[model samples]
Target: MKSRKGVRAAVTLAAAALGALAFDGTASAAPLPPGGGSWDHVWKGSSGDFTIYVKEYGDVVSICDTKADGKTPTVWVGPGNGHTTQYWFTAPGGKGACNTKSSSDGAKYRLKRGQKYTVTGCAWGCNTWDFRDRH
Candidate 1:
């Protein structure tokens, strides 16, 4: 009877240890931005494809992109650990007439007469890029 009790206590301790390990990583869960809106769009780069998701932290907009299959997207902020692509403001990059202001970089991602912003994640990489307001 004494041995049986010891075995049961050991098993319970092991189970508790495992549970603690599982919950250890939960603290880093991605912080959800206001309005529950994500600005992630699938993009197909020359090397591969990825998805860009935008969100807000405090007063800044963040952008994060992950590879569609294998390759990781090079974000201006950091690794695409599911939440490393957050941005605050956007300055005009590429050349185009923008209809909507990008919340990620605060720049207008629009279309230009002789310029083009390589937009990814649209019908296999062949779509005219334009910034559309989120509804």
Candidate 2:
């Protein structure tokens, strides 16, 4: 009887584990705020370096770079790990936007409505540029 109960408990635990794994496949929104995307792949431009960062405690979006150091100090413009500051907005078509409040200026990172920009080691305007997915 003791052996049977032990086996039953093990089976129950296994079933619960499988159930949890099953729910893992459910679709969910990005953990980051709107306009946030993985910046693992970066695009360099003539303007400067642009990185996608989160904004406003996951409320808004912004892009930052050393190219615009004159406008504001570049903060919250690095790779994000799903932080509230790293979340971004993905448009209906997969395009996304990001913003940050850590910068000295208030400009946010935005995806150009109809234009596409190249990512290079150099700097570019995040407000007028759309980050192309490297994935």
Candidate 3:
């Protein structure tokens, strides 16, 4: 049987050790899986037409565009992940317009490390009237 004094001493040492290792405290949004397998693959469109693969918390690994008419837009301009891209598009009924180009596509594009990429544009501006899938 261990004495009470011995148990108290052991717990005090453990607390000191834990305090040393927990400095500069930071937390994660999701628990990392075993062997570092906490990859998050989310489909974040309203219609579920695109897939964004994020690994290691916020690293975007790959983006898969499933829709035939859907164009995978890049956050950067000038010869991006696709051949066709628009700087900005007007909303339906031409009420508002947003400009995203940097004077003929020379803007520096850098992905943020701990932030989410959001493409805010007119939701109904790029809709096609007729979409026929032949698969």
Candidates in descending lDDT order: 2, 3, 1
- Total clashing pairs in model 3: 0
Per-residue lDDT tens digits for candidate 1, residues 1-135, read 112111101100000000001111444322222233433332223322322333212112222222233322332321122133222222122111011123233333211222212222221231112222222
Model 3, span 10-66: residue lDDT tens:
000000000001111233122111232333322223443332223322222223333
Clashes of each: 20, 28, 0
Query: Judged by TM-score, which candidate is best?
Result: 3
TM-score of 2: 0.20
lDDT of each: 0.22, 0.25, 0.23
Least well predicted 10-residue stretch by lDDT in candidate 3: 10-19
Ten-residue stretch with the least lDDT total in model 2: 11-20
Model 1 error, position 6 (Å): 54
Error of 3 at 44 (Å): 2.7
Off by over 4 Å in 1: 1-25, 31-35, 38-51, 54-62, 65-108, 112-117, 120-135
